[model samples]
Target: MARNDGYEDLGAWSEFGTVSGMVAARTTESLTEAHTGLGDRPDDLDGLPDVTVGVSAAEAIGDLAAELSPPPPKGYDNEVDADGDGTLDDATYRGRADGGVDILVDVDGDGRTDFIGADTDLDNRVDHADYDKDGDGVFEKRMFDDDGDGFLDRSVFLNPGS
Candidate 1:
């Protein structure tokens, strides 16, 4: 198991015989199970060594689904009140260890989520977002990182002609 705590460096290491269920990281700022020391071992490793180097950071921590558990939803204590009503109408869900966050906003204070911003890949950046302009259970605008470069580059409108 390889881990990074954002304060140490990870160098190349060689493994010899029959490596199975190996989670290795080559970056110095990755959050793996080895970093937080929390999570359960995966059940379906194919007996091949897994290396998380130049590929994707998600590849390094994907197996630790149980490790990157998200926290319970709570009130979003920010200053952006879309409806301008004094009461905050947004709630946020964050990861317990990894750097992932999801914010749900009720624009009209109607108890329905009209906007969602998230960093689903744990990259400390908002790479996906959905906007339900009317808060009627359907998103009208969506943006996401189609290339997985940790940036939201693609945008689509659900009702283009509307």
Candidate 2:
């Protein structure tokens, strides 16, 4: 027998139907650990497409179902309170499904994210990030961590393409 490799999103619209994908695992443990959110909770399939209803109504019900569902496991492992107001102002998402980590920070607890860092290699270190200085919503510049040392070593101003 051959060892199973892993699974990834195959994109929308396939012969398998919507909300469907291939799972190439022989054991239940492998299927549960695959980042498909199967281990999170049991979904009643209320979001499935209903041909009897109009598209807008079906969409509304699906949105409601999504809102009522619980979040996935290991979604956010790290959190920070920037202003000491007893509320989490920032969070770091160690993505198991996307296979990367993203750190979002709101420096002053003003409810606006001022900085974002991305770890593309899943090494717990940011490779690049966009920064919003002066509390504005627009990201003014970008920084890069060339050595994966958790310290941004390079900076560049954003100007359209560069």
Candidate 3:
């Protein structure tokens, strides 16, 4: 008889809508161990881990998740006519979990952002920003948080064509 590589067993088990109880138990234990290795309290996904060792695992996970997630889709949480131009020139959007905020300005009433400022760490400071500094639609100046430490640590200027 050929050696059973477990695929045959898995296919057989799939017809029953569930794995065997023993397999399920082992799977659960493996998953629990993996979560524990990540410093997470497997029983409570939302609960912070015990931090006697150092930083809580939950905080680390949150920071990583925030960095990995895409920026909030382009939309304004608040709008105001900051330039007395009788049109909404300023738009702001608050970060979902980090309390950060993004501010966008539509300087020419084109419904497109001409300037962008963001506080990625919710520290009441702008950590990243872009500006169309020359009255052009293109953002020529950029401030970025190179270390993810909620500080704008780098600035870049781009030419018109590049």
> Each candidate's TM vs. the true structure?
0.36, 0.43, 0.33
Off by over 4 Å in 1: 1-69, 72-89, 94-99, 145-154, 159-162
TM value for model 2: 0.43
**Can you write out model 1's per-residue Cα lDDT over 1-162, one digit (the tens) per residue?**
344445333433323221322433334236543444556778667977666466444334433543566663353333233333666555545454444566566676665567666765555445677888775567799888778765568889978887
Give the Å error, residue 30, model 1.
82
* Model 2 poorest ten-residue lDDT run: 18-27
Model 3, range 9-106, lDDT digits (tens) per residue? 44554645454776877888778445445674367566775556654554465357557655654543444343436665556453545556666666
lDDT score, candidate 3: 0.60
lDDT of 2 by residue, 6-119 (tens): 545554544355324334334444664455554676656798754555345534653465465444345345454433367865463434345665566767566656777776
* Model 3 clashing-pair count: 0
Q: What local distance difference test score does each model get? A: 0.57, 0.60, 0.60
Model 3 spans > 4 angstroms off: 1-89, 94-99, 144-154, 159-161
| Candidate 2: segments with Cα more than 4 A from true spot | 1-89, 92-98, 160-162
